[model samples]
Target: MKTPKFLLPVGLACATVLSLLSAFNMPSWANFKDAPKEIIDEVWQVVNREYVDPTFNNQNWQETRRKYLAKDYKSREDAYKSTREMLKGLGDPYTRFMDPKQYESMKVETSGDYQGVGIQLGLDEKTHELTVVSPIEDTPAFTAGVKPKDVLLSIDGRSTKGMDIDQAVNFIRGQAGTSVALKFRREGKPLTLSLVRTRIELKPVKYSLRTEGDRRVGYIRLSQFNAYAAKDMGNAVAKLTREQADGFILDLRSNPGGLLYASADIARLWLSEGTIVSTVDRDGQRESITVSRPAMTSKPLVVLVDGASASASEILGGALQDHHRAVLVGTRTYGKGLVQSVHSLSDGSGVAVTIAHYQTPSGRDINKKGIDPDIKVELTKEMAKNLKADQVATLADPQYARAVDVLGQQIAGMPVEQVVAAAGKPFPAERQPVAAENQTPVATP
Candidate 1:
């Protein structure tokens, strides 16, 4: 793996506005109280000052604030509803309003303890259908044979058609002893599964040393890019390299994404020296992040991605592909180049404002256009649903098998270099049809 640097950029106009963001960026569950009008104003002010799209989706930002503030909000619920209405005008699903429960749920999933059926959900911007981003390992959803990209049809007899991310999560989560029924479609067949809710622990990284032919392959399945992902990944790489793994396969199949900085740290593990990724603001100014440290391993590498892979997954995958540090396998990624900076307001409710958009090292804007893998191995619905966790990175998994074959070729012809080559002609810049419309991680479980 090479050591690459990653960064998220935020445009700050002045110290006054910067301090305003700092004060409002408290923990989602923090105890805070304010009038409904005050809370509404705070959210509007933040979006106006820092939203990545200075044009505010071609609408008047000042008029938007005045319109929302003019309405009389009797309670926080009223304010939240109005806030969501304001965000919708931006035409960006990534920048949305999160009630206290939803924000706290997101916080627990990405950084703290959480409870649920062990599933992360996403919304398709085009269809407005709730889909499975991933099922956290060792959770009820995973055990019930839930797979990524399954189009959610209903939850507890309620249809998910036209449902946004927030509504789906609120329906799925409940008390630990409660059971929830989820109906989704896979390969044109409908299936319903009932799962008992429970406390879910966020275990981000799962690794194994697999024997393929005569080569030892280090298999690392990053379920999500949470707080613990990078550290766990480092440990996995170190231990596997110690065991003399000939190559490594980093699997980011269904990961929806988590923390931004966590993705940065994980990219550095495989990049030695090069500009990993860059962030561009609305004004066309750019900030590029580069690292010159030695890579953890110069061994051959491959990354597996699918339609459910979004956000931080795209960031890490893009960097590796740009540096040619790892060959990408599987299908095109979910496009989510926009970066959202989430902040909890005084009333515990939170706002995720699109602060900037990222570009691949080759200056590819993968917003509506996702990154195409170097080796495309189409994953059929049957194949995605039939493979068990244990079978991944083994012969039974078609994508992993293809990754191994590609890794084997690299191993046979690669040299033993301590540092990866500098960026020359990166992997062919290709874009594919966008799969999921929105892939925001809005819940913990």
Candidate 2:
């Protein structure tokens, strides 16, 4: 049967709309052909009908597809770069294209093993200058004389002023043989330092035994839940136990986070074999991360935390607290419950997206609401002075004293009040804040 002329034109138009809608549903222009025909058609139809952008056209899309499949783009490298540009047009940094080489590098970095100076660096909130938070002891950065409070100006002549902390780390990290020059300002003097990049396998957990007053307490600081953190923690605990540590102080003050698996493993040290943390995706799909019943010791514990404690820190703290395995001291923690999964891009750069938000074993949502300490204490001037003198900025920080005090009380079989009375009040009338006259802000002329 012969089709009507007007109906044929209308039918062709309808078909075009359907095809365009399908593309919208799948947005990956390069991969559209690989998708099911029905899905592709749906994407095209949706885009044609609902997309507010007036530039939508079948010809433009066809040309984009042709360029991707062209034979002249002989190398896989060329094809990937072209595809990357196409994805970048979307302007979402979270969804960029990365080649395999760059993607693999990211995977290595995320695994918490890389070649570089060992330091956690960040921008100064007040100065907006790059600052070294802490240099892991015994690493290239630590041995090469990188210090906290040192403001980085440049790395290899590249300005670090406007770069993010992660970017600075990337700049400093290189193959084991290469040397990176770092320029920094310390105490009004500009200093230049050069060091070779070496393999850095960070051990996140560190511990020591200290006799505070009459009781010997174990002090363990966990920097991040990296690949070896759980094992490191176990060894630290074992070492502390051999030292006859009467009580435990688990310090998780400035830790950011690393592997989720490591976090669960660390938590399992003091927790029963059960849900350490639960995750909820954007779609409301829920899953839980649990651990096996395996650990070195189950001693009376006190975990110290502050505003900088985040992610896996919260997970470990929440688990111990819920299980009555430890008492939390110091200040509120940093709440970062989102779990990121790295996806390799064709351009070598990896994209990490927040696939889920994790919850504590007790069903507490640790995303925005951080863990509150059982005992709140401020850092003492004396402790700060000690830290400054020892070149140990974080350890002698006030949070350390709080942890020791809490654990000391537990050892003596008395409340913190009894220990406070014996040691005398740390803060007296002289330590109280002095009040000044309330003044209004002066306007600049």
Candidate 3:
């Protein structure tokens, strides 16, 4: 059978429609109204053939199709509802059916620019509460003091109990200059914030240089792994290198991740030749993505991660850690190693289905088991508040401070064992230093 023409590249965590039909080319309402059964059958067939989990999460796929198809879907809305119910039976959060509106929103989000209160939201599996994944820096939500892991209680006075991610996003998004009231709970305390929506153009990469005596440490914070991330990061590294930066700190805190290719491209900046990541399909077929580009920098490196770091963030961090190129510091990262590909349907809707599971360069699976920091640093309530208020200096943030310290020691030619001992963290058996000869030479741009 010929594959669908709308198949696109894989995205991590969030749903991002890759290939889409133009609005003008979408099927008319009358067509949808007459072909509800056909639409429902298409959805079922796609999931049955392409879902990553062959067992269907132990749910009978044919039974689900039969149960949903038994009812007569007289309208497009009815077919949409039935399709969603069918997907929900798969028990995978990343695999979901998107209606036309939701599919449009996904496209806008993947484009790296949009109008909304800038924030990425996720649903908490345990509590079933809508949680703030991360606030886009300098946007309305970020400026309004929205922090990661904040549980959303309500939106504009309507409770978010049992609300899905798309529904919550719709409630929070509005026209530029409009306002949305958000009630949320942070650290077990209730709080409210009002934010004005705006045209959010994400500058995914931000950098600043910190001085420690005669040495300058280049600090780069990657907010997400969007399409422009690699280019922006390259510019930052080049500028910092020209400024005589001797060490580097990569902050991946609260980064929920984006495109897989973007993450691999960023990894190539530090690694000259090595496995960046590997993906395993349902049939045990494994494909490795290796770094093809030359190294941008050979400076001593430290990576900062937190509970909110996931997907592509984990991929980059894990590759660096496995290659012994950088030491990870901070709390355990959010583990999300599943790969999803979004397919555009004939009716302008879409379905993001999990296609495979990815592994780090060292062959470690980080799905439910998150990557542990080489040196763990937990944030205190006071420090969290200070960070939100922009009152804390870079050195005052525990994780970041630790990363800088480690990077400084590495620049001074400290041994890995000594660095671990100094940080008061146990040295793992796998923690070995990469020999100088094994380190790839930095390539000139």
Ten contiguous residues with the weakest lDDT in model 3: 1-10
TM-score of 2: 0.64
Candidate 2 weakest ten by summed lDDT: 6-15
Arrange candidates, best TM-score first.
Answer: 3, 1, 2
Give candidates' CA RMSD values in order: 8.2, 15.1, 5.5
Candidates 1 and 3: which is better by lDDT? 3
RMSD of 1: 8.2
Clashes of 2: 25
Q: Which candidate has the top score in lDDT?
A: 3
Off by over 4 Å in 1: 1-18, 21-33, 157-163, 185-190, 382-390, 415-445
How many angstroms is residue 152 displaced in model 1 relative to the true structure, after the best TM-score fit? 3.0
* TM-score of each candidate structure, all chains considered together: 0.84, 0.64, 0.88
Pairs in steric clash, model 3: none
How close to the true structure is residue 406 of candidate 3, measured as C-alpha lDDT?
Answer: 88
- Please give the lDDT score at residue 135 for candidate 2: 68
Q: Select the stronger candidate by TM-score from 1 and 3.
A: 3
lDDT scores in order: 0.74, 0.59, 0.77
Q: Write the per-residue lDDT of candidate 3 for residues 1-445, one digit (tens) a residue.
A: 2223222223432333343233332233344434876567666666776678999999887777667766777788888877877877777767777777887787777778888999888877667789998998889898888889999999999999866677677778879999899999998999999889999887899898889666698989999987689999999999999999998999999999888878888899998877777777787777776765679998888899989999899989998887878888888999888887776677777677787888887677889788998888898777676674453327767777778778889999986566777778766655332233333322212
lDDT of 1 by residue, 95-167 (tens): 7777888867656655536667987777777876777877887899999989776889999999987566766
- CA displacement after TM-score superposition, residue 270 of candidate 3 (Å): 0.3
Q: Residue by residue across 1-445, what tens digits does model 2's lDDT show?
A: 1111100000000000111122333454454343323222222233233222234322364454444444345455555555545433432222323345544544565566788877666555457688765566678887877765679999999988656554576678889979999999988899999888899877677778877788877878787766578788888888899999898888777675666666666776776555666666555656666655565676678888876677778878887766556777777876666564443322233333334566676667766678776667655546444565344423355666656666766776864344434444332222121121231111111
